[model samples]
Target: MWEVFLYINPLCSFCLKVEQSIIDFTRKNNIDTQYHFVTTSNMETINDYMILKGMKPCDLEGRIGVTQDVYDASLLYKAAACQGNKKARNLLMNLQQEVNTNQRPYNDETIKLAVEKSGLDYKAIMTEKSGDAVKEAVKKDQELACKMHVEKAPTVIVFDDEDPTKPGVMINQFGSETSEEIINENLIAMLEKTMPHQISEPKSKYYTNDSIINIERYRR
Candidate 1:
């Protein structure tokens, strides 16, 4: 099994499509994988990050129309992950589709709709949304991203095993017309280079305290 740390922002269109491609590629390859969807957008740096990633200022201004804060949306994503990673990933996919395809704002209403669509424990999530545990989870993810020196969304760090604490391979190049085949090939090549000797069973490790708590929550 492999673990991949994926840094993304709900407002990033490229991140949305690229993540879906990676997920599809992993499934097609029959790879046992775990995904950590780290929400990397902050209120301070989101506009600048978007522009640096090649989004035109005029277009961004038009799209947002007004100041749109994404911190709450990011926190919502972390809360969803508390329920389960798969559920969180599904919620993210739906949220991204709503934002990118339907031009929906990243707001409480949008998040509520995504939560409903994902079939997660809505009451639990809502209750925990403002709790310390959920806040810590979101903060931990952001801190991890900073520790990894991640400067952009859609950045993927692939580990040979389920533990991401160990050093991993980072994939920095994702083309405009990125395909599942291309992603699969790149991942295979990286895995080969990183894990030349295959181990029978690798011990799984969580990157943060919040991760461990979430896994336990899923089990209960």
Candidate 2:
């Protein structure tokens, strides 16, 4: 009954490893989990975050270099999310896998393969060029990420159904750690500690109202 949201960017080596770690942890522990993939470019998001945190834009790496192709791919990911959950997760993860694993830029063939594996028509998703849809999806996703206060890639927030109000803890760069076993153990502990009670179940009588983490408190 607990929910865990994994904010990830597939292109990062660390993120890819974290994804694998989560998968292994879930499989081994028999946990039901949900992954919310953040398709935004980390550098751009970080720049915005720094500014929001009252940091100066002068410190940002705008002129340092960012390819438009990556931005385009981000939009594509948002578009996928809009269609459905299954399609979105599959395509988003697969595309990220392809992009991260590849040494070259985004290729039609690679993207197509990712789409097909996701049970989608690669050509149709590619051909649909509705500006508003892509724009709105990307905007909503960015807004959500900002609301989540995510500062980096592959950051995970674990929630316990029993305590629903308090999210247990979070982890950054779960994958590619020196010890994968340790990482899994830590995640399992967090998962066990954070899961919230389901709506079908009784609410906690001990909730003092002081320890609850109100999701609405998050500022955009």
lDDT of 1: 0.65
lDDT of 2 by residue, 1-220 (tens): 4455667553444555666787777777677765556655556544543443355657535323332445666766766665676687778778767765664446777777787888876656765535677777666766766766666655666655555566446565333334665556556545544543311223222111112265544322
- Error in Å for residue 136 of model 2: 1.8
lDDT of 1 at 127: 80
Tens-digit lDDT track of model 1 for 6-61: 88875566677768877876787677887877888544346654564455555757
| Model 2 misplaced stretches (Cα beyond 4 Å) | 44-67, 102-104, 127-130, 173-179, 195-212, 216-220
Which pairs in model 2 have colliding backbones?
A: 159-194, 160-194, 160-195, 160-196, 161-195, 161-196, 161-197, 162-196, 162-197
Error of 2 at 24 (Å): 2.9
